[model samples]
Target: MKNLNKLYILLFAVLVFATSCEDLTEINEDPNRPTEVPVEYLLTSAERQLGNRLYGGFDNVAFGMTVSQYWAQNEYSDETRYQFRANTNNTFWSDFYTAINDLQEIKKVNTTIDKGQQGINQNAVATILQSWAYHSMVDIYGDIPFEEALQGVDIPSPAYSDQELIYSALIDSVSSAVAAIDPSAPGFPGGDVIFDGDLSKWQKFGNSLLLRIGIRLSDVNPSLAEQTISAAAEGAMKSNADNAAIQYITAQPNVNPLYVSYVVNGRQDYCATENFIELLNGLGDPRIGEYFVPAANTGTFEGLPYGVTSAVAAGISRDAVSQLNPQVYAADFPGTLMGFVETSFILAEAASNGWIGGSAADYYAQAITASMNYWNITDGNAIGDYIAANPYTEDNLKVQKYIAMYYEGWQSWAEIRRLDLESLPAANLVEIDPAVNFVDVSNILNRRLYPQDEQNLNGANYQNAASNIGSDAYDTNLFWDLD
Candidate 1:
C-alpha cells in the first residue's frame, strides 16, 4: 500500500510539470507583437523604401545627379569626378532589392488570403511597382537577376538574365498587371499612398511604364519595341493628374530627401553644373529660377564647373554658384516615380521612331509644354515662346527632353546614353575643363559596375555575368545601347 501511494504521487507530479511547461510556452507569445504584418502595411513600407532611395540624398546625388551632371559636388567632388563611393553603390543595389522583396511579399500575401477583386487590385499594384523597380535597375546595371531575384535561401545566387529577356518579361508582366486591375474594387483602403487605391491611375502608370520599357528596346529589339509601344500609347498617362508620385509630409521619417540632405543636415555640398545652368540660360528658360537659387554673393545664377578637382572646387565660393532651390528641398515636395511629362517625351520619341501613330512634332510640343507646366512656369507666353524657338527637330527633341528631365538623374542618364547624345554639341559630353580630365574615359558613364558584394558573396555567378557583359567596365554599353 505504501509503494502504491508513492508511485501515484510521482505520476501526479509529472503531470503537473508537463502542464506547467505547456503554459510557459503559451506565455512566450506576446499579443502586442505580431509574427506577420498585414499586406497593406507591407505596401506602405515598400513604397516608402523605394521613395527614399530614389529621391533621397545619398544615392540620388552621389550616383544619379552627379553621374548625369545635373548637380556637381561642391566640396568632395570625388563623385562628381566619376569616383562613386563603394558604400553608396552597395546601398543603391541592396535597397532596391529589398524594396522589390517587400513588393513580392505583398503579392504573395494578397494572392493567398483574398482571392476576390481587392486581392486582384492589390496584386496588380505590387506587380507594377516591382516592374518599375526592376526597370530602373536594369537600366542602370544592364542585366540583373529578375525571375529568381527574391527567392532568399532557395536561390542564393541568381543568374543574371539577359537584358533583352528581362525587357520582354517586364513588358508582359506590366501588361498583365494593367489588365488585372479591377477599377470597381476598393484596393488597400489605407496604405495606397501613391494613388489612394485608384485602380485607373495605377493602370495608366502601368501602361506608361510599358511604353518606357518598350522604347528602351528600340535599338536592340525593334519589332518587340514597336509592338509594345503601339499597344501602350493609348493607355498611358493623360495628364499630370495621373502622375505616379508620393507626397512627403513635414514629419520625422517622411520629410523630402532633399530637405534632409541640405537643410536638416546643413550641408552645402552640391551646386548646379555649369553645363546645365548655361544651357538653361542660353535657351531663355523661365524655370531656371525654379530649379536653382541665385548666388548670394553675386546675386546671379552662376554654376560650379563640372568634374573639377576638390582643390579647384574649394577655391569656388559656396555663395557664388547657384544651389538647388529651396522649393525643391521643401519638406512637402513630392517624389515623382513617373509622371506625365516623362510619358509625353517617351511618346514623342516613339512617334519619332515610327513605332506609334502620332505626329512627333505635336508630341514634342506637348512634352515641352508639360515640362514647363510641371515646373510651375505660370507664364503661358514664356512656354509658347520657348517651344516655338526650339522646334521639333530630332536634335531638338533629345535636347529638350534632357532639359525637361532635370532633377530626374537616372532617367536623364539613361536617355542620354540611349540616344547617343554624346556627339551632339548641346550634350556637352566633352570635358569642360580640358586641362583637368577627371574621368579615365572620354565619354560619359554608360553603366554602373555591379556592387562589390555581388562579387564577394556570389562569386561564380558574378564572374559569369561580368564576363558575359564584356568586362563590366563603366564605359561598357548596355545590350540596348547600340550606340
Candidate 2:
C-alpha cells in the first residue's frame, strides 16, 4: 500500500487570478441561487481547504499528526518536517490571501443575504467562518496580510499586519458573530458540508471557536482568558454530538480529503508515530483500535516506542504492527477537524487552573469521555475513573492531551514548545548538547524558518518576517511561545 499521492499538494500550485477592482467590490452577488457562484464562496471554500492539503509545508495533517507531540517524531534526517519552517515548496500565504480576497468580495454584499426569513443567522454563519479563516491564517504564519487582507480588489498588494492584531480581531469578530446568531431562524442553507447548517450547531461552533481563541491567549492575557472562558462555557459544545466537524464525501473529487492521498492513490505513506502510540497503549486506552491499523494480517497491533534513534528505527519491522494508517481510518476517528471535545478540553483546562470559575476536573472528564464516546468505545468507563485510577501527574496530563489531540494541527507542538510537560518515557535527539548549551531548558526547537520561497518570490519581505520572529527556520520560537 506504499504509494505516492500525498505529494499532490507539494507539486501543484494554484494560479490565483489578478484581482480587479470590481472583484473586490462585493462579497456575495446572489441571494438565491442553488450552486450559484457567489463572491463570498471563497469563505466556504477556504474553510473546507483547512481540512485539505494546501502544500508540502502547510499540511495540518502531517504537522498535527507527525510533527506535534500527539504523534511520532520523525526518524528521518530533518526535524524541519516535524515543526514549522518557511518551506520553499509551501504557498500558504498565497492561498490565505487568495481566500482573503474572496472573503472581502463576499463582505461587500454580505448584507444582501440578510433577507427576511433566515437572513440574520446566514450572515452570522458567514462571519463565523471568516473569523476561522483569519485565525487559521495568522496562527501558521505570524503577522500575515490582515486588516487589508480579504479586501479583494481593494488592495492588491496587501501589507502584512502583526499577528497580534489578527488574534485580537478574531476575539472580537467571533464574539460578535456568535451573539448575532438567531438560533430559531427558519431559513438556513439546505446543503451544508459541516453541521448541516443548523443554526444552533453553528452557535456551538462559534462558541467553541471562541474558547479556542481564549486559550490561545491564556499565557499572554489571563484577564481575557477568564472572561472568554466564562462566555465559552455558556454556549460551547456540550457533547461529541455537537462537534463542528465537516464530513467529507467519499465520492470522486469529494472523498475525505486525506483519502485521495492516503487511500485511493495507493500510497500508505503516513502512519502513526511511535511517541503517540506508546502513550496511548501504556494507559490501556481503547482509541488505538479506532486510530491505527492493528499491525495488519498477522494481527498484531504494533505500538512503537517514542523518541527512538535512527538505529532503533531500523529495528522495528513494518509487519502487522500497532500503527495508524489512513486506509483503516474510520468515520469517527478522533479527528483534528474542530469539535465539541476540543472545545470542552480547552474549557476543562481553563476551569482547572481557576482562570475561570468552573470545575476543571469535571470539564476535563467530560472532554475525555466525550472523545472516547466519539470512537464508539463507551464501555462504562468514565474519564474521572481512568484519571483517578491512573496517576494524574504532569506527564500523564501531557500524554493524555497528546492522545486527545490526535489529527489536530500544530497546537500540540506549541504546547511542547511552551510548557515543559513532565518528561515522557522517550529520548530526544537534541541537536545541541544539553551540557554545552548553558540554557536552562535542554534542547528545544521553536519556530520553523522561512521556506525556500522567501528567498525567491518574497525575498525581502520574507527576510523581514523572519527577522521579526528572530528565526526564519525551525530553530526559532514564535513570539507567543515564550514561556
Candidate 3:
C-alpha cells in the first residue's frame, strides 16, 4: 500500500512539472485586452483624448475660467478662491499623461510596424501632436517630464526637463514634422479629426503652433523668438478654413465637454463673469449673445462676480446670472485647438515686435474679422463697424485677443498672463464680498501648482522642479513669463 501511494505522488509531481513547463502564457493571456491596435484607431483616440483634455469642463471651469476671469462659479467657489483640492491637479495630470502616452504609442507603431514613406507622413502627424501635448504641459507647469516621458517599463521616473529646453525641442519637432510630410503618400484619413488627413493643413497647423511657441519666448529669449516667429509666419494658418479644430458629435461619449458638464452632470455651476461680460458689453461686441445667454429673470445680460465665496454665491438667484450660450453648450459644438484668428493675433504681435513683415494693424483687423466669421457673425456691416471701433492699440489688441479666446479658457489665461494685462485684475480689480473668506486679494495666480502625485511618486524630481521654479505656489511665474 505504501509503495502504491509513493508511485501516485511521483506521477502527480511529474504531471504538475510538465504542465508548468508547457506554454501557459497564451492560456493566461486576457482575451479582451489587445496587444496592438490599428494606428488609425489610435490616432483617432489620441485626437479625441486631446480635445477632451483641452476643452474639458474640469479644467475650463475649475481653473481656466476663474483664472482668466471669463466665468465664475455660482456655488462651489473653492477653485476660484485658489483653494484647489488635491484631486483637481491629480485629475488634470493624469488625463494629460494618458493622452501623451497614446501619442507616444502612435509614434512607436509608425516607426516599427508602418515603416515607409507613408509611415513618415503618419509619423509626422504623431510628432506634431506629441509636441503639442508636451508644449501644453510646459505652458501649465513650467517644467515637466519631456526627455524620458512615456518610456513605459524602461524608465519609470523620468527627470524633468527645463521649460526652455522643452520649448526648443518642441519647435524642432514641429519643424521636422512639417518638413517630413509627403502629400503623395498614403494617410490616415478616418483618424484625422482636425484636418481630415490634409497634410498641407497639418503643416499649416504645425507652423501656427510654432508661431505660438515662438511668441511665447518673446519676453525671455527675444533673439530666438524673432528667428522662430519669422520662420513660422511663412507657413502659418492663412484662413479660417485652415483652422485646427475638432468637431464633436451628438453622441454620449463624443459629446462636447461643456454639454457633458452642464447637461449630463445637471450642474449650473458656471456663469459669465462680470469682468468679461463688462468688457464685451463695453466694447459693444456683437458676439455677446453668441457667447452667453440673457439672464433668465431680467431677460438682460448680467454676470457674476468671480472668486466669490460659497456663501456670497448662495445669496444670488441662479436665474439672474447669465449662463453660457445654448449653442456653445450644445453637444455638437466644435472644439477649437487653434484658429486663424489666433494665428492672426500672433502675427500682429510679431509685427509689433518687428519680428515679421506686414502691418500690425492689418493683422489685427484680419484677426477681428476671422473671429467674427468663426462665431458665424456674417453681418458684414456689423463686422466692419466693430473692426472700425476697435483699432490696433496695444491694449485693444490684448483685450480683443482675450475676447477671441472665450471658450478656450487656458489659452486666454496664458495670453492674459503673458501680456501681464493690468486692465484685467484677477483679484483686486473689483472688491469681493466681505463675507467671502479665504480670498487672497493680494496675489494673482500666474501658474497652476504641480500635481500633488509628483510629490509622492516622484518626490526628488518634484522638489527639483519646485526649487527651480522658485516655489510650488500657483503665484510663481514661469521662465517665459518674465515681463
Assess candidate 2 and give its TM-score to the true structure: 0.78
- Best-to-worst ranking by lDDT: 1, 3, 2
Q: TM-scores across all candidates?
A: 0.95, 0.78, 0.91
Please give, for residues 160-275, the per-residue lDDT of candidate 2 as tens digits: 66777777788888888788877777634554556666788888888888887777777777788778877777888777778766566556654465555456564443455554
Task: List candidate 1 segments past 4 Å from native.
Answer: 1-18, 432-439
Q: Candidate 3, 12: how far from true, in Å?
A: 19
Give the whole-model CA lDDT for all candidates, comma-separated.
Answer: 0.86, 0.59, 0.83
Clashing pairs in 3: none
Please tell me which predicted candidate would have the highest lDDT against the true structure: 1
- What lDDT score goes with residue 378 in model 1? 58
lDDT of 3 by residue, 180-284 (tens): 988888777577888889988888999999999998898889999998889989899999999888878999898888889888988868888887778788888
Worst 10 residues of 2 by lDDT: 74-83
Cα misplacement distance, residue 67 of candidate 2 (Å): 0.7
Q: In angstroms, give how far residue 174 of model 1 lies from its true place.
A: 0.8
Ranking by TM-score: 1, 3, 2
Residue 337 in candidate 3, Cα distance off native in Å: 1.4
